[model samples]
Target: MDELRRALQTRIEAGTLPGAVAAVASSDGRARVDALGVTEFGGEVPMRRGTPFRITSMTKPMVAAVAMMLVEDGTLTLDAPVESWLPELAGRRVLRRLDAALADTVPAQRPILVEDLLTFRLGHGLLLGPESDYPVAAAGRALDLTLAEPFPRTPYAPDEWLRRFASLPLMYQPGARWAYSTGTLLLGVLLSRASGVPLDDLLRDRLFTPLGMTSTGFTLTPSTAAQLPAHYQAGERQDLSPPSLWTQRPPFPDGSAGLASTVDDVLAFGRFLLSAGADLLTPSSVQAMTTNHLTGPQIESAGILLDGSGWGYGMSVTVRPDDISGPGRYGWDGGYGTSWCNDPATGRVCVLLTQVSDIFWNGTMPEFLHLALRCNVPA
Candidate 1:
């Protein structure tokens, strides 16, 4: 753990990351948090434990938990057609080919199930196209969808967002391919509609309140906002507009790629999931949520960091263990440089927060993962 702390501080001093905070925990509730460096370059405000991180796609797991809450109560069923709750997705169309023109399409063979959203199998997602100017990127930009390469500042309201998103044909039939991001966003809308409340409010009531995750939310309070740092991409500072997006209400309270949280809050979430939902979910539900949902071929590209793991509801479940992390560990990383893993086998939960986009490119995140897992055991 001492060496781990020094490595993080060394990176901060060398300016690889503007700032970082991490929390590591064991199933017995023992945990340790580390914060290092200044929040901005050539600035004096040092990073602290309370600093809020733009947790990006890490929000998916929490949103997934909310959906499971509804499912546990019979408000939603796993395999049921989501059209009953989300009308905008009623009759989806699929593109004839992934790179085909917008007009080339076919009707969907089956309704997108509620399960598809949890499993990221609703087809369309941020497909890493062969080129930067891929058609999927252009189509999403055409819809003004805040896909967050630069980090989402403003967003279309949920209804308008979904309608515009639905305008693009799904890349494949429902459940045919394990797409990512879009399904989680759709789940936010579906859950909100099913519960008769906004997604933010719904999460606050069912997830944040129940778990005591007081510092987690799509928007932040003024105090919490003060602790956030500038975003970085490819080692350069990436600016976002309406700076208050973290402090106040955003145009869209995104379930897929929004939410800011502290290391404490993230560790709290890890604890809850490791505790088998700790009353927020049943043991069976937790098992199902953390279980691998992908088939043999679908496991190939769930993510870059978690390359070969099978995805579960929002996180990736390891089918085979890596060198440092073992199988049965589940969690997701964020585009805005945040990651968390809950290892049920070792009873370890590791969370790392930073402000750099594509933090994986620099190898710091993976190094941290290895160190943290190696240090999981007590001295």
Candidate 2:
């Protein structure tokens, strides 16, 4: 374990990453944690256990948990049409792909439900693919959305972004397939509307306070902001531009990809879901949240291949028993190189945190996680 930590530290020192923090824990009372490198390249501050990093889409699972809490409270239903709560989504339409242009085509076969967002079955895209001729390309052009670059300086406000989103045509019919869209952001909005509270406050009251995750939130304090590592691209320091669709403030606590957290704080969250301590959810709710809800292969191409490995409500389930050799191994990753997985079968969980994008799909982080899982299993 020490040797692996040293190797990881070497990679940080060699500029392979700005810095990183990792943790491994098991129900048998074995654990290891390490913080390596600097929060920013060429900066003197050493990464610590509490150093905050932008967790990006890692925010999804937390949002999903909160939504499920609402589900348990009877404030929301997984199968209820979202338009009942937010009328803006009423009269939704799909887009038509012509030879060279996009057109508003037809009303969806059905209205989008709250469950659709949890399973990512709503007619939306990640705004990066050309597979479906949804007006994503056009919307991206109109909205100036680009993945290769940082968010635009003068971005759209949250309400404005929602208005624009409501105006755009969906890529497919609701609940037809899994598409990785900004559904979580919509979920956040729905949460606020349903709970009659701000998104951040609701999350803090519902999940963070109970779980003791004090360091996790949508915005960082000025004190904590200094400790946040700068985002990077291709091993170089990158500018931290304002988001294109929302500011890091109230009225826009984006539940989709806006939040910062530290290793320890998130680990507490992992422990809660893994049921290492008092469980926040009933076993049936947990099972429902982690089970694959998508009916077919439509979700597989969108990266919700949870059943094959499996997918629960907001987390990804390990469909292949060999993937982690567990009965209930499930978790998710963020775009900013942060990932976590829990194996209920072995009573083990591993987390890797970084600020680089595209880490889970193609980076050493996933490989390191697999190695740690293999090594930490009790023989």
Point to the candidate with the largest lDDT.
1
Worst 10 residues of 1 by lDDT: 146-155
lDDT of 1 by residue, 90-155 (tens): 888888887877778899999999999999888877777553445665778767786534254445
- In TM-score terms, candidate 1 sits at 0.95
lDDT of 2 at 352: 83
How far residue 116's Cα lies from its native spot in candidate 2, in Å, is: 0.3
lDDT of 1 at 108: 96
Against the unseen true structure, what C-alpha lDDT does each candidate score? 0.82, 0.71
At residue 138, candidate 1 shows an lDDT of: 79
Q: Cα RMSDs of all predictions? A: 2.0, 3.6
Model 2, runs deviating above 4 Å:
28-30, 98-102, 130-134, 144-159, 241-250, 276-279, 303-308, 321-328, 376-379
